[model samples]
Target chain A: MTAKLAERPAGADLVRSGIRAQAANSSFAFVVRAAAVSVFVILVLIVVTMTREAWPAFWHSGLGFVTGTDWSPSADLYGALPFVYGTMVSSLMALVLALPVSIGIALFINEYAPRRLRAPGVYLVDLLAAIPSVVYGLWGVLVLGPFLLPYVQKVADTIGTWPVFSAVFGGPVGLKSMFLAALILTIMIVPIITSITREVFDTVPADQKAAAVALGATRWEMVRGAVFPHSRNGMVAAVLLGLGRAMGETIAVALVIGSTAQITTRIFAPADSMAAVIANTFGESSGVNRAALIGLGVVLFAMTIVVNMAGQFVARRSGRKGAGT
Target chain B: MTVPAALHVPPTEAPPTALATEGLGVYYGDWLAVDDITLQVPRHHITAFIGPSGCGKSTLLRCFNRMNDLIAGARVVGRVTYGDVDLYDDRIDPVQVRRRIGMVFQRPNPFPKSVYDNVAYGLRVHAMTEDLDDRVEDALRRAALWDDVKGALKKSALALSGGQQQRLCIARTIAVEPDIVLMDEPCSALDPIATGRIEDLMQELRRDYTILIVTHNMQQAARASDYAAFLTTEVDGDGDRRRGKLVEFAATNELFTHPQDPRTENYITGRFG
Candidate 1:
């Protein structure tokens, strides 16, 4: 067939070669497109299932289901605000704690590490990101949580004396609290941010850095003046992507977050993130409760999409501005 | 049989001969890149390093500033001194050494910050504070970039053209007021027009600052250098490596007219690289 194609008639040869090239390209494209469509189907299935289950709740209780504060299902009030608050709080806390650490790790790997060690260090950090979120939750619950709560409580009480730390602890100690969840979340996001920030830093032109160093700029000065500026937009996007992961985290957040739907005021208190609430209640819920849980998923999905879009938009604008400069 | 071209300098501004090197050698991970380079770039003159590709010209240029130290496993043997101070001394910080000897790269590499910030970077790093805005402006003027960039002080450095970026780098380097400026093929990546601008800029800069440039463009070396060093490499008998030594050192016109070494004669005449 190959020989025939090679010696094929002129018009037929063009068609054969074109077809062969198209076939090769299309095979790759077909796989990629199939994977994309598979993801689309999965997302659609998830949304449809969630809405099917959550619709009954909206019909039965309306917007009040989201606004209601009473979450004791046994006595029968299931407001989701408290859980939503808990999820938002813990995720934000994780972001706040993880962002700077991630940037530090990334910079350390990119510019600060001794020449021989940089690549290996980055790989080790990325390995941490690959660890399952559940393992993090388990470790947080068994090892880290007990080690942490006292310090957290003490700091809370100390700073709690000040207005900023005023809220009393509301979440569970390990398996049911905002502090544990956030800590686990922080541990998880660190790897993601580190890997991405390092990769972005690598994208900075070596000549650009050389230019700064040539000017009598110190190593720190080169990073502060050149590398950091070039990678800032990318770093921001990386952090936001990590934040989205933190926000949507289910197994880890659920494992540690105390499952409750009540909004409360303490950093160390027990609480529920969106996924945690859904995971905890979905199995037992029928009709309205199931629908409510699915509603929770929809809200989470929308939030994830919003976070991604905003991050991408900021990244694009920053890249343009950097290019313009 | 005959001496290689001795690098020449304008007799008026030649640095004191006492502080220069003898037999400078460089190694990269056990591979000798630059060999048997002996030349003096006296103070206050433009000395250009000219050679074929992979002739260790860049390595030789970087050795003066110890910029090669930044590369891992890059080892240097031989003496580089400033007055009585040995540059490779344990007491000497590469940072401090670099402050005295500045560099400009092949491609224009400006920090991504505003043009003002890019100029200010070196000053702030060295803790040299005396009317920073004035210093920034002075450096820019010295590099001939101030006129174009003055209005856009706050604009990002990345916004500049390739030529402008290279000039910005030169301005940033001089902000520290270094004693020597090293350039490694500074115009290799530029268009002829940009290359011409850099040559003119080099001539103007040589008035107050000493410069060492490595260039493959023999014409550029001929045009801009007050002093020129020619370097090359060879595989010795039994697989030992050796560098091509200086062919002759004389004023640009004299060397081109009467190259003493056969290699130099061939190179200048464009018979071989």
Candidate 2:
């Protein structure tokens, strides 16, 4: 037994195995680090490639590309202001129209709905999101647009007489118009906003809600006092996410926005969005026009990043505040 | 310390009853959580409910202001009355009942709002907005949080310490001038010093509000409460599940020094829960 123990490897063998274990650990770390770094690498690559593709348009239009409104392709005037305005107005309007309805739906599902109905209600809302954007666009153009055109026209004629309303509701209501595009966008984003808002509302601590209720707050008052204040940042984040979705929606807005390049205050008038313009004109464009479309894509990408970053900031701040409490 | 046998005689005059439950039983769906319990909460006194875990002490406390109604399947049998009014009556609005009878929870759940706003929330909800500043200050003072937070009224209540937040909750509850304040393990989440501070505040609050507190700590019940009720879990007939039943109810000193039931004695002596 003593001879066998002397022949067996000592510290040298243990050191060799330890070195092997360290190599294995280092290789595992390297794999995970590569995976984590790849996300940043891919994001940077996309930005660089898109910017390079858009360089010619930037050189051709200079600063006037963003500031100028005209977009006559034959004349080489590729001003993107109209598309930007249409995108902003349509997306913001959709958000304005959708936010209240989404909040109401969320509160109804989470707070007021019967226990048995809540799951079905949530599933139905989620199912709305499952419908394709193209289908929504097709429905918007074929069905809702035509159905609402006459009523919209009538409203424009009557309420359009008011000074402030004239700018918004004015003139000839087209079958495919900004209003139709915005309405479609509203429907598309509602489910996203409602689901997120519902999740945020669910994060409100039960004890805080009880505190409010125990203090004689009516159901509505409890919502206003406890639920609303606690969920403010989360709700903002949800709305911003919905805004990002609305702004980037391509095929749907392209189908219903009539591919017009003009800027108008009238919701009934045909207009074009950044995403819609790219989708519509990309097929036949070349040289600077194509680059200008890609430039628009870059701009939309930047806008989405900004909105999403703001959302992340708010969410993180709320998370920290929640943890502190 | 031994007391004379003659001095142990029960007082003939009982304090006026502020709230009472008659043959009250609480059920969550098919499960009986708390069996039939009948007890009176005397006016302007602190009553503590002591029991082991899963004894439905919290459930019984929630029954006072109808907070149990907020739970999906929670049901209460029999009557809970405040003064002459039945709290569960169809004509009685639970919201109104809550205004008259408020509650503090186990964890200090201050709204993520300004300290002033937290206190003012109740006052604003009840439309008692007149002298809002004074009323808020008065409540904060009553809850023993005024000096600590007076200068920071605009700060978020969440930024306050745990003890301070619980005091803010107490201030918020009493700002509406509720007749009874129900607390469900209000200090169970606090450190010993924080717990002591709350106990001191409770003694001060007992002059105006009839406070009902549920505590797992028998020592807390002995030290802080004027009257005490002991609860224990008992197996239901032919069932494996246990439901909470009241074992003893009496003056705090009497209940601690001389328990009427063997279960209460065993529990107080730390023999078995």
Candidate 3:
């Protein structure tokens, strides 16, 4: 036995080198950590660049940069209140208009569609997302404006009679107005909210659904009890994402918003958003004017971030509540 | 549907049969999962379906409550009767059938909700909201889970241990006061100690509800059940296809000691499945 063992060739060790193996594992971990940290670094870099470029406007105007409404580049007067009002009203209008319609479409696709029609229905809804914003802008200018002008005029004429309605809906109602811009934005954001909410509803566990039906819940009741409760946080997140998209939209709003620096309560009146103003004026402006445009970009970025953070906070708290004690 | 009228009020107390299947066969598309299963489940008694895996015992149990209807391609042939009402009749709403006949699944599927909410779910769904807290407490008491979870009623049901969750599911089912309860392998996911607790709970529940349990554990069938239905799979000529069929159903003692069918005898003797 000893002679045979000696004649046999020595086998390689089965165990790997501990240091080498650990080094390989930690090398992959370090790559992941680097990728994770880069997001924060990139955000900080953008903020620094914006703040540095915007310093001249901040020093010249101080708080007037936000509260002032004048915008004459020749005189170096720059106020962002009109643009801020425009962004807030248009985005809020889009959200209010799109949320119910999106939810209805999502529920119809997931629950009420025939088995054979479900896939194609979902595909059609998702196809809405593929339509370029430029195309929507072109449609808003060429087709939507002509189509909705009479209705806008009629509403402005009729509601303009009442004291309260006149206060809110007064002024010239035109083809290119805040209402048209918001309507276009609503069209663009609906598919986004719809698809995300539909996917969230689909993720509701089959067992919980069964539990609800087993308790004698009607079809609608099952949706209320099991499907809605399970996906409430996800639906909120989807709406916030849609709001973000609407707030940052530039080309579409600029095309139809009749870019003007006047804050008016009348949604039918022409107004300017931060993005629309920047996109329209960034080419011709120079010196403090260019710095002021960058400052508006900073404000828009901050607003979007604050809204997104609030959305995430709400989603997280509701998630914890759903998880129970 | 109006309140109280919408409820399934038994015309008479202690009906001889809670659920009876006549020539019942369940099929998933073309594949017959369970065939020609005709059985009468005695009211307020524990009837256990015992067999090896893939024997369609759970399939047959689902048929009683029309839970099989939830499966996309699944279809049931023949009639399942509850009292004078034919459960499979076209006019009968499955939602009402399910409310009258509740079910407990193999796994503990407590909703991501508080323990109190879990028990109150059926009550609220059925519009039985008048004495909700009292009803929830009574259900927890009946399921033998009240003592352990009383202090944590507001706690998430998911925070409970496996056995406690199963008992919570039972409480949820019984809170609606269904006339019959179907349990599909209720104790299979639990440890021996938890299994023992559930078996004891079953004994207490039998006094108020008709219990039909599908169990793979023959010992459990022998120990806890008043009646035993033995089932086994029979392979077709190609040997690639198998279907479940009932072999013998008798009193638990008789079925265990002197099984009529040779296959059942072999199974009981641990000779073959």
How close is every model to the real structure, measured as TM-score?
0.89, 0.93, 0.88
- lDDT tens per residue, model 2, A172-274: 8789999999999999999999998899899898988888999988999999998898888888998899999999999999999988989999999999999
**How far in Å is the alpha carbon of B41 misplaced in model 2?**
1.6
Q: List the residue pairs that clash in candidate 3.
A: none
lDDT of 2 by residue, B50-163 (tens): 989989999999999999999989999989989998888999999999999999999999998899999999999999999999999999999999999999999888888999
How do all the candidates rank in terms of TM-score, highest first?
Answer: 2, 1, 3
Each candidate's DockQ: 0.58, 0.60, 0.54
- Name model 3 segments beyond 4 Å from true: A1-42, A72-75, A154-172, A309-325, B1-15, B237-239
DockQ of 1: 0.58
Model number with the top TM-score: 2
lDDT of 2 at B224: 85
Model 3, span A188-242: residue lDDT tens: 9999899988988898888888888877778788888778878888888888888
Off by over 4 Å in 1: A1-12, A15-35, A65-68, A74-76, A156-159, A162-164, A168-176, A312-325, B1-9, B12-19, B240-244
Kindly give the stretch of ten consecutive residues in candidate 2 chain B with the minimal lDDT sum: B1-10
| TM-score for predicted model 1 compared with the true structure | 0.89
Docking class of predicted structure 1? medium
In the order shown, the chain A TM-scores of the predictions are 0.84, 0.91, 0.88
Q: Report the candidate with higher lDDT, 2 versus 3.
A: 2
